[model samples]
Each structure stands twice: as C-alpha cells, then as structure tokens.
Target: MRCETIREALSARIDGEPEPVAAGSADRHLDACADCRSWYRRAESLQRTLTARPGPPVPDLTADILRRLPPDWPLSSVP
Candidate 1:
C-alpha cells in the first residue's frame, strides 16, 4: 500500500473501525515505513490522553443573564 493510503487507514485502525483487510494493509505499511509508524504512535498517544481526561463541566448561566438578552438575539451571536 502507498504511504498516503496507509496514513488514511491509520486512524480507522486506531479506532478499530477498519475492515480486517484494510487494517492488515495499514499494519504492513506501518511495519515498513518509519514515518507512518511514528504517526501511528502519536495518534495512539493522543487518543489515550484525550480518553483519560475528564470532559468539560457544564456552564452555569443565571436567569438574570437570560432575561437581559434581547428577545431576538441569536445564540450564534454569542462567543
């Protein structure tokens, strides 16, 4: 498989979403390509870090703030 093809499949392999044939092809390419292997390791590391972190807390908006907003004000206008 070409480097680009393997790189495209790398994420699917990491996510366990690729079919066995594609995954095997990516694995074979990774074994032969040092750059792709590094990329795969980095992808795995990022996935692990993100999965380990806690999700962001929900914001607490008071009724007073809601009341102060114009009736026609769109939520998209906010930051």
Candidate 2:
C-alpha cells in the first residue's frame, strides 16, 4: 500500500480498530518504507505519552469538600 494510505491506517491498526489494509500489510509497508516506519514510531510514542498523562483534576473538589466540613476543621485558614 502507498505510504499515505498506510499512514492513515496506522492509527486504526495500532488501536485495533477497523482499517483499510489487511493483516500483515501494514507491517510489510513499514519494513519497506522508512518514512512510514518513522511516522508510525512517532505516532506510537505520542499515543503512549497521551495515555500516560494524568487526567484533569476533579472540578472544585477542595471547595466542595471544605463546604461539607466545618470551618473549624481547617488546620490553617490564613492561606
């Protein structure tokens, strides 16, 4: 398959979603195409980074907890 076509399918293949190319086709393309291989490597690294990142904090969690507790429960309110 052409690099562009394979590149688009690379993500689907990695994610185990449906892709245009048959099984082993992407691997074959990667072996023969340095550019596609590099692109695939970069994409894989990006997915790893994205999946590893911490999710966003719960919204206003501190405020909600503080509201549920007594004011005297605070250790230091000066801050």
Candidate 3:
C-alpha cells in the first residue's frame, strides 16, 4: 500500500472509524516504513492528548442555522 493511503487508514483507525480489511496491510507497511512509523506514533500521541483534555464547548450549529433561516424557508425541500 502507498504511504498516503496507509496514513489515512492510520488516522481513521485511531478515531475508531470504520475501515476495510486492508488496514492490516497498512500495519505491515508501518513495519517497513520509518516515516509511517513516526506518523503513526504522532497520530497515537495526538489521539491520547485529545482524549486526555476536555473538549471545548461545542456550539449548537444546527440550532444556530435554524435560527438564521427565514420563517418561510422550505425546510422540507432540504436534503
């Protein structure tokens, strides 16, 4: 597998996102590629850092958007 594809899979795996069976291929590539190994380490570190810290308060973007919409806006037409 290419470095770019493996890197994407690495991030997705860290995020607990779904991926194909080829994730194992990415792992094997990690074993062979020093740069990918470093990237994986950094990705892991970042994931840990994010999990350890409190998330910033997330604004309710959906509600904000609803408020901005006109009363006559065709909500039913939105996908």
The C-alpha lDDT values of all candidates are 0.80, 0.84, 0.88
Give per-model TM-scores.
0.62, 0.68, 0.63
After the best TM-score superposition of candidate 2, give how far the Cα of residue 18 lies from its true spot, in angstroms. 1.3
Q: Write the per-residue lDDT of candidate 1 for residues 1-79, one digit (tens) a residue.
A: 7777777788777787854455667777888899999988999999999989998997777777878898998979778
Give candidate 1's root-mean-square deviation (CA, Å). Answer: 5.3
lDDT of 3 by residue, 48-75 (tens): 9989999789877998898899999999
Deviation (Å) of 34 in candidate 2: 0.4
Better of 1 and 2 by lDDT: 2
Query: How far off is residue 18 in model 3, in Å?
Result: 1.4
Q: Which stretches of candidate 1 lie over 4 Å from their true place?
A: 19-21, 59-79
Q: Compared to the true structure, candidate 3 yields what TM-score?
A: 0.63
Distance from true position, residue 60, model 3, in Å? 17
lDDT, model 2: 0.84
